[model samples]
Target: MLPEIITPIPGPRSRELAGKLRRHESQNVTYLAEDFPVFWQRAAGTNVWDADGNRYLDLTSAFGVSGLGHTNPQVRAALVAQSADLLHAMGDVHPTAVKTELCAQLSALTFERWGAGPGKVVLGNSGSDAIEAALKTSLLYTGNAGVIAFTGAYHGLGLGALSTVGIPFFREPFRTQLKEFATLLPYPFGPAGDMLRLRKELVATIQRRAIGCILVEPIQGRGGCVVPPAEFLPMLRTVCDEYGLLLVLDEIYTGFNRTGALFACEDSKVVPDIVCLGKALTGGFPLSACVGRADVMDAWPPSSGEALHTTTFLGNPLGCAMALAALAEHARPAVAAQVQASGQRLKSALEKMRSPHIWNVRGRGLMLGVELIKADGAPFTDLAIAIVTRALQDGLLLLADGPASNVLSITPPFSIDDEEIAFVAARLQEYLTALPGSIS
Candidate 1:
């Protein structure tokens, strides 16, 4: 029962709030639109209501932050219970029982999935923090400052993580301030021949550089939900083993059943030396973890009064409790199956369209994308934006992502009903069919 457009998007109240926010909020952080941005008042499951009372079906899952869905009941209940008991604890100085239990669960899960042997975890408040910890771990363990990263990769926005980010626009502004410790390489995304060339290049770089780690996204998320060849990850594993380099998989976006597998790396049986997890880690709370093999994590010297890397909010009791609940909910076999089935259905529908505008439709499980193209096969960024904007007006929220911003990222909640999926597909088809310019 979505598409409840009671008023124009960003209605009067939203517009008023936007004007007020503009006066105080920094321009860099605001996602300003023409009239006003859609101000969310509340959300539940896969539906979000704006300040104007327009209920839209969220397709992007609030940038993949709410995998268990917005305001998930289980996570909310955990948050309430934890808040009533223990609200805050000094991170790194005094860890709470909840933090210990959460870490133990994560370690056990990592061991069971990757056979990494009772891995250890370092908690953080965001995905960028997780990446920072992973980077430091690599430096300490391998004693090499150089790290290998892939093109179109988005580790995070913090200085440490930004140093390794592959996106030019995201890194360009802070290039001079950031250290040049990462070597960016092309990600293999095409046929066997293309993958082989990329693999050769990667090997050559490893030989020439003092690389301590190879940091990568199992399936590129912000880079348009790009899914590399199935062999890509397995090849990376082989190369890492050959070069004695630690493999760091950033599963911040692809974890928590967003991909068909619990972790996209699991599909290839690739056990990374370090795994950075966040986004959906706490359902909707700010929590992240840098987990890895015990030996690697233990490389850092024991704290002699001053810990090297620790945050103020490192495993807040509420976040940890919510994370525990989220993990349990996401671990259900039914949840995983639903994601796989829904993704397959959506991808199949897009593939069947055979529209001239669609260059490709690819992704794994719920992390899907539709790459739009012009008649000449060039990326149609304008068309992609138009579709997304139009869908919003129709009460179907969407997002455009990719190097050229020509891919529609469709990452709905795992709990989204089949009817909602069908509605999204049908609406997309209708819009594409009725696009202003006819195919030449």
Candidate 2:
């Protein structure tokens, strides 16, 4: 039971305030608009209400952060309980019970992959931090600084993570800092020639550069929810094995139940040397982790040696409790089954749509994308943006991504119901069919 919209998006008051905020704000990073930027008043379950009282279906899940739905009751309760006991504690110095509990649970979940070696967990405050941690772990383990990453792959925005990210636009400005340590590989998506060259180059790069690690996304999220070719990951694993390059899987977006598996590597049976997880890990709370083989993770020594990395809120107890609850909630067989079923229904509905602009629709489980195509079958970025804007006007929160940013990404909360899925599909169909310049 979602709430109803009572006014045009942003409303009069929201527009007025947005203007005032824009004056002092950077205005570049924040995507605020006078006509449409919905000011979120509150959220619960799969719906959110703007300041003007208009409710949204929450398709984007606040950038895929809310895994178990918005403001989950269990997580909220856990947060409150942990807060009452202790707000902040020295994580690396004096670990709390909740922090230890969370690490233990995560270890149990990853036991099949990490085994009982020195493989352990490193906590952080965000996805980029976790990614940076993984990057550091790789460097320390192999004692090499070089890294290989795929085109269109986004690891994080930090210096270390950015160095490994393959997107040029995001990193070009900081190229001086990233170029020396980074090597970009081709992302296997379209065209046979490009993919063939990419495969050959990847192996060559590993051998030539003496690469210490290869950072990859199980499924590229910001790169338009792009799913790689069936042979991509396994082949990369083979290359890593041959070169002794540590394989690091950035599951910040594809982890949790979003990909219908606890981890996306499960589909390909490709076990990475290091795994970086975030986004829904803490169920909307700010928590991230780098978990992997003990030898790789233990690159940093224990208290006997100085801590290489430390954060003011490293193993946040409140965040840990909420994460534990989130993990437990999604661990249920029933919840996992629901995500798989719903994702199939959503994908099927998209596949059935006939749009002259749609080039392709591909993804696994809840993380999916609809890529817009031109007449000659080239990727069309504008068309994707148009569809997203139209959907937003119709009360859906959507985004576009990829090298072109022409992918209409539909990664809603897994708790979204069947009716909501049908409604979203129907709305997009209507919008594209009626919109000006739409190919239909």
Candidate 3:
């Protein structure tokens, strides 16, 4: 229930395991640092115990995948039930009963509830898979190959998804392999006039390229949880409608009550033609869905005994069972309220710090960011990473993301208690206050 750091972080056992991993696994996969990358041995609720048995409060929710809480009882029970009856199945061909149920529930929760007809579902194993599915659907439905994405957006890293990924760091190495179908536009965060001008630029790009869809994240998660103005989504919706472009919302990070609302787009009252969902969809299981408007999704021709797009683990039964249980838990009214309250408490605590290094603390619900900057107004990337290191030593596990890696990403499970939130706030303030005058 609370953090208990028994030994120094990266304790003896973790160091040994990290050494083993460095020898056998790809070094590029996991950043192996002397004092970082603690291997998780167990996680429950808002806590994670490293291999060395050091317990720490999790603020990242394991990359926003455990919204309901790590190893939620209901989801675990569902996993157990599914494992006994069935485990894996032919996702695209001979589907399991739970998969069908999950697809229907996802449709009901999204498109159907949003005034669209029953939604069409394309299940996948990761967020990138879902994004690719949406991209493919857009291409087929609109008969256009090009897509419009935002600079600060992070859809995924798969080939199809990477084509539209906004981060140049991820795409640079694979540029030759990519199809060059994506055009990145500056994500808006300024004013009404800026958004209006963006609309004009969007129209110009649509006219110049074979643009079929516009892909974006409602609240840029990996992009420092940068939440645009209220007019941002509505402006995109207006332009998409006027130009016959499909609006594809990548809610992989902001979905499942992380944003107070079930989906961030709901607050804006803008219904995207297609939405990619993952991370917390199944608590801990690897499952994602690309749910689209019935009319838009139906653009794919019926299977002629063969599917156009699918994966070996497309709709694994275990994932479906857990997803069903997680969705049921999200249906409870307390989940949203808990998220909103917990977020406000954490945000308020951070704002009260008044540390000069603090630039901004903004986000909806549990998905919040604390931007760190130097007096010169440059992103404090080194200090942000240092803060993460210091926080870890103090029994708080967080991440610094965004282009400059200067924003502390604080997305905890909805079930986190006020005490844990207080612990995190106190630790953050301590770290910021201790910095030298030259930096602060």
- Could you say which candidate leads in lDDT? 3
**Candidate 3: regions farther than 4 A off:** 190-193, 436-440
Worst 10 residues of 1 by lDDT: 187-196
Off by over 4 Å in 1: 191-193, 437-440
TM agreement with the true structure for every prediction: 0.97, 0.95, 0.98
Expressed as tens digits, the lDDT of each residue in 229-257 for candidate 3 is 89999989999999899999999999989
TM-score attained by model 2? 0.95
**Predictions in order: lDDT:** 0.87, 0.82, 0.90
Point out where model 2 deviates above 4 Å: 113-118, 190-197
lDDT of 1 at 379: 87
Q: Would you list the rank order by TM-score, best first?
A: 3, 1, 2
User: lDDT tens string, model 2, 221-336?
Assistant: 99888787777788888888888889889999998888898888888888888888899988778899998887777777776644788798999888999999988887777777
lDDT of 1 by residue, 1-440 (tens): 56699987778888888888888999888887865369999999999999999999999899898988899999999999999999899878888999999998888777546766888899999999999999999999999989999889999999999988887989998888999999999877744437678888888888888899999999999988888888888888889899888999999999989997788888888888889999998988899999989998999889896789998898899999999999998878888888898788877776776578888788989899999988888888888887887888889889999888999999988777767877888888887888675253
RMSD of each: 1.4, 2.0, 1.3
